[model samples]
Target chain A: MSTIEIAGKTLELDADGNLANLSDWNEDVARELAKGEGIEELTDRHWQVINYMRKVYQENGDAPSIRKLTKESGVDTKELYSLFPKGPAKKSAKIAGLPKPKGCI
Target chain B: MAEPIEKVSIVISHGSLEGVYPGLIMANGARMEGIEATVFFTFFGLDAIIDKRMDNLGVATVGNPAMRMPGGIKMPTWLGAIPGMSRFATYMMKKEMEKLDIPPVREFIEMIHDAGGEIYACKATVDMFHLSENDFCSSLDEIITVGEFYEKSAGAKIIFT
Candidate 1:
């Protein structure tokens, strides 16, 4: 893990660039985190996936996979990829301050 | 760390659940890692993209070792040869996969395609099986020859499953 300055706060990020401290995340932090992932801006659609990921992680103590996100996360696979270029499951989770997903589909 | 490879071109040569899933899973996994991926269905692999047979494909239970019971007990060869054993094995495997949220064959194809991975059929295999363009699933990107496959797979790692 390492530290990066965002919104005037030094935030610790894990190896995958995910926020190490949950309390360190805010909309500003999320936007900056997303920018590091090559996402220029967090539109409403992007927030949809991020918020869903945070909610699921909060309730289940883990992040949902791509299947769960597509099936119930109010977004389909195509749109999810468009929103977060490559792996939406991991990318969106990082932006949501959740750990990386470990399972393979 | 740097990405090991840029793209993968998977060749699925088997029709059974064990045969086809390796290629599908690999391609889908590649896309998940932000790598380009493509699946080439040839020979018995055609069964995977064939709309009429895709959903009905079964795993091999006969004349095979490593087959097992629910608790991991080894399955006897004789038991595997029973008339309905293959179907039963396929059923059990599907149920297990469902519990893990693995999508069915058709859905998996759609997932890969939508994730920017390409899917295709071998022209020679399609002809050998007396099949036509209309026989494939809607997600199939094209029906090409071995030479065409090689061309499309240029600069990509070739994985035969």
Candidate 2:
């Protein structure tokens, strides 16, 4: 595993440089991304999508598109954003422990 | 935004004659752009997969105003329920496609298959709808569930019409 500090918070990632949060990412990372700082709470649905995204990144070596993620996880895009607030893949991906996906920036 | 890579996997969940065409058209368009494409047919969308009915498809009329001629006239949704509507819609769509130099649905399917695109049927939808493999085109890749489709769609873009 490795770690990288974005803003003031240090994020722990796996060997493949994936998001290490897995299914437990509350809003800490999300708050960090959204407010460009830190967070305190996250929902179960957030963890579900983050974990699924991590799995997908591992297998495909890339982040799944929002549409694919929604279809796979059966989560609506609106619900996904409500959880992330800033953006689903951007903040969620960071907390999930994934490297910055190409084409997203 | 990054130009989407040509490696997109598209899952189409429509089976109506008109509805089914979008799936095929987009799949073929993806291939034309050299993107990896896949089409999953579920529910009534299987009508396109069924070899017997593929050649005959219909247009959307219910609450749909685009079902008119070049003059942009209005037509009834119930008109699509008529016997000949399917055939007429099929012909009209084909004609418009030909005018645009787009391939016919059959040819488009074949092109997609030959170009390494995938075609699948929804197993649950088939079971629920009382459809069998024989009802679909012989070129199908598999009869999969939504989960399988999701897995396949991973890392790819999805366009739903």
Q: For each candidate, what's the DockQ?
A: 0.76, 0.01
Model 2 per-residue lDDT tens digits across residues A54-85:
78888988777544555577676556655664
Q: What are the TM-scores, per candidate, against the unseen true structure?
A: 0.96, 0.54
Question: Residue A5, candidate 1: how far off, in angstroms?
Answer: 1.1
lDDT of 1 by residue, B17-103 (tens): 999998888998888888899899999999999999999999898767878988899999898988998989999999988987789
**What interface RMSD does candidate 1 have?**
1.0
**By summed lDDT, which 10 consecutive residues of candidate 2 chain B come out lowest?**
B26-35
B1-161 per-residue lDDT for model 2 (tens digits): 97767556665666565677667767755654446788887667777777887776666546566677546666677875678765676677778766554555565675566556789888898899788777777678898888998899887887765
TM-score of chain B of each: 0.96, 0.83
Worst 10 residues of 1 chain B by lDDT: B61-70
Badly placed stretches (over 4 Å) of model 1 are B1-3
Per DockQ, the best of the predicted structures is 1
